[model samples]
Target: MEKDWPSGFPGINWLGRQEEEAVADVVRKGALFRYYGPQSPTHVDQLEEYARTFYDVDHALAVNSGTGALFTAMSALGVGPGTEVIVPALLWVATVTAVIQNNAIPVLCEVDRSFNMDPEDLEKKITPRTKLIAVVHMAGTPCDMDAIMRIANKHNIPVLEDCAQCNGGSFRKRKVGTFGKVGMYSLQINKNVTAGEGGLLVTNDEKLYTRLVAAHDLGVPWKKGLPDETGEVCFWGQGRRMGELAGAVANIQLRKLSHVIAHMKASKQRIKDMLGHMEGVSFRRLNDPDGDTGPFLILMFDKESHAGGVAQHLTNGGIDNVFHLSNYGLHIYHNIRSLVEKVPLSPAGNPWSLSQNSDSLFEYGKGTCPTSDDLFERSVIVTIPSRLTDEQELEMTQAIKNAIVANVTS
Candidate 1:
C-alpha cells in the first residue's frame, strides 16, 4: 500500500531561532525603525549591504514593498506624465500599476512562449517617446536579457528589471537582477525571501543608486549634502523605507536563499523528468535551465481541450493544478479594465493625448496580445514548495501521472 502523503507540503522555513532572536532583539532595543541607528550595524544597513553583495551590485535600497521599489526606480529615472515605459504584456498587476504610479504610460509589448518579453515585439514598441523598458522575469524565469539589452541599447533606452518573482533566477550565469540598469525584488509572504512585506532595489550605477535611495527615502541622502537656513535638508521623496524588524528577518532569510533555491531546483527538475514524457503534455522550456530557481512546475498541453481535461483530472485526484487562463479570476493585463480605457480610468491612453510624441499610438481591449492569451490558455502551473522530500516528490509525480492517464482520451 502507498503511504499517504501529508495533507500539505511543509512550506519553506529559514525562519527559526535566528529570526525569533532577531525580532526579539529589535523589540528589546526598540530599534524597529531602520533609521533609528545609533548602533554600529543596524538591521536596515546590514540588509542593504548584504543584498548589494549578494547580487554583486553596487547598491541596494530596502523599501516598503516591491511596488514601491519599481515606482521609485521609475521616478528616479525621470518617468513621468507622457513618457512611455515598455512592459511585457503578461506580468503581475504591480508591474503595470507601478508604471502608472509614476504617471507614465505602460507600452505593453508581446510575450512569446517563453512567458517573457518578446524581444522582437519589444523593439517594435520603441519610439522617440519611450522613456524606459521594464522587463519582468516571470515565474522565476529570466527574460531574454541578451536580446532585450541589445534592443534597448539600439534605441538608447534604459532598462528596469522586475525581478520580484526571480530572486535567485539568472541568465547566462549572471543573476537576473544584475542584467538591467536597476532591478527590484519582492520579499512578500509568497516570495523566495520573505520579510513579511518588503522590497529591495539594486543598481550598479552610482548616480542611479543615489537617486533611487533619495527617491525612496523622502529625497534625503544617507550622507547629508546641504541644509536649508533653519538647518533642515529637503529632498523630493516619500517614506518607502523598510522596518528594521522586517530587515532583520530578511537578513536571516537571505542567508538561506541559496540553499532554498537549490532544493527547489532539484525538486522541480526531478518532477519535470518524471512528467516530461506524458502523452499530450508539455513543459515550459527554460532558456537557461541551469539558471532557473525552480519555484514552479509549469506544464502545457498540446491542445486547450487536453489541458482542460488534465486540470479536471488533477482536481479529481485531490491535487490543485491551476489552469493559468479560463480561471474565474486572473490578474493578467488583458483582464485589467483600468489599463485599457480612456481618460482617468485609462491612464496609459490619457497620457497619449498629452504626450509630445502622440499620434494617438496606443490601443487596448480584448486580444491586445494574442500570443500571451494563447500561452496562458494552454498551460497549467503547479506551485513547488521550497523543500520536497523524496517520498513527497514521488507521491506528487505519481498523482500527476495518474491524473493525466485518467483524463487522456484516444
Candidate 2:
C-alpha cells in the first residue's frame, strides 16, 4: 500500500491579502487597462518598474501572455517571413508557435543533459539565413550561456532567452534572462510569480525597448499626443498588452519573489539531500547545480523501460502526477502533428508555405534531435509544489524511493 501524502502535497494557499487589496483597488477605480496617457493609472508602470529593478535591465515590457512576449520580441528583433530562428527541441510548443507567428522557420536544436540547447548543435544549425537563436532555460536551470554566447557572437546571431520556466535562476552569479540580448518571462498561473496570464520582456538596448513597446501596443508611439512626437512614430505591431489588473497583482507578487525563491531553494536542497544517494536514480545534471529554482524534481533512470515501470508504480500508488515524459500528456515532443504539417497562422496559410521559406530546409519528426529523444524517454518527472514543508519533501522523496524499489528492484 502507498503511504499517505501530506496535506500540502497537491497545493497550498499562496495568495493572500496582498493580492486581494491589489485587485480590489484596481476594480474599485475601474482602471482595467494599461495606458501611457496622463490620465492612465500607474499600475502597469509600477509592475514594469518592479520588473526592471528586479532583472536589473534598462526596460521591461509587459504583454498578455508568455507567448505574446516571444512573438513581440521576435517582431522587435526584425524576424519575419524567411527568417530562420534556432530553438531547442525540448521546450513548450509555444516557443515554436511564436516563431511561426512571426512567419519565421524554427530550426530545432538538440539539448544536453541540462535539458537546454546544446551549443554544438546550435552552431551547426546556423546558416546565412539564420536571424536569431531562441533558447529556453528549461526546468529552472540555466543553460550553458557562456558557450552559447560565444557561438552567438561568432555568428553575429541574436539570442532570446526564454525564462518562462526559470525565472530568477542564474549561472555563475548572473541571472538567466539577462544573458541574451532579450529575455522573456511568463507570469502565468503556475509560474514562480504570476498575474494570472502575463509576460515580461527585458532588454538593455534602448532602441529595441522602444520597438518592443510599440510592437505590443499596436505601434502607437509613446506620447503620441505630446509635443515631442516626431512624425507620429510609425511601426508594425500586434496588440498584446497585459491587462491592468494582472499588472497590479503581479506587482505585489514581485515583492514576494525573493522570499518564495528562498523557500523553494531550501525545499529543493532538502529533497536532494534525501534522495541524492539513492542507487540507480539520479537528478538532472545542471551546469550550475546551485542555480536551479526547484520548480520540479526530475529523475533519470538507467533505462527507458525502468523509468516507465517506476512511473507506473507511482501511479498505482495513487500518485497520478508522476509522468514518463515520452508519452506524457501535453509534454510529448515526438511525432507532433503540428510540426509535421504546416501551421495555420492566417486564413491563406501565408507563413508555412510562403515563397520566403521555399528554399529553407525546415525538418521536424521523430529523429530530429536524437539526444533529446533519448533523454525524454529515460526521464520521469515529479512536479515540486511551489510551497512545500520539510515533512512533505521527505514524503515525496520516500514515495519515489518506494516506487523505484517496488518496480525496478528486479
Give Cα-based local distance difference scores for all models: 0.77, 0.80
Query: What residue runs in model 2 are displaced by over 4 Å at the alpha carbon?
Result: 1-13, 36-41, 224-233, 329-332
Question: Model 1, range 1-410, lDDT digits (tens) per residue?
Answer: 13453322212355678888888888888777765443435787888888888899888889989988988888889987768888887788788887777767788888887788999999888878799999999887889889999998888999999998888788998999898899999988888878888899999998888788778876756664232224233357877888888888888888778887888889888988877687677788787887888877777777777667777766666665344453514347767776776346353444555655364367666688878778777877776666667977887788778767766645
On residues 1-410, what C-alpha lDDT tens digit does candidate 2 reach at each position? 22444222211235779888988888877777666433355677888888888888988888999999998999889898888989887888888888887888888899888878999899999989899999999877889999999999998999999999888888887888898889999888778778878899999988888888878877755654232235244677788888888888888887777676777778778878887676777788887876777777788888898899888877777664678867764344554567767657777884658898877866787787888889888989876666766677777778888888876665
Give the C-alpha lDDT of model 1. 0.77
- lDDT accuracy of residue 186 in candidate 2: 88
Which candidate leads the pack in lDDT?
2
For model 1, the superposed segments whose C-alpha errors exceed 4 Å read 1-12, 37-40, 224-235, 326-331, 342-360
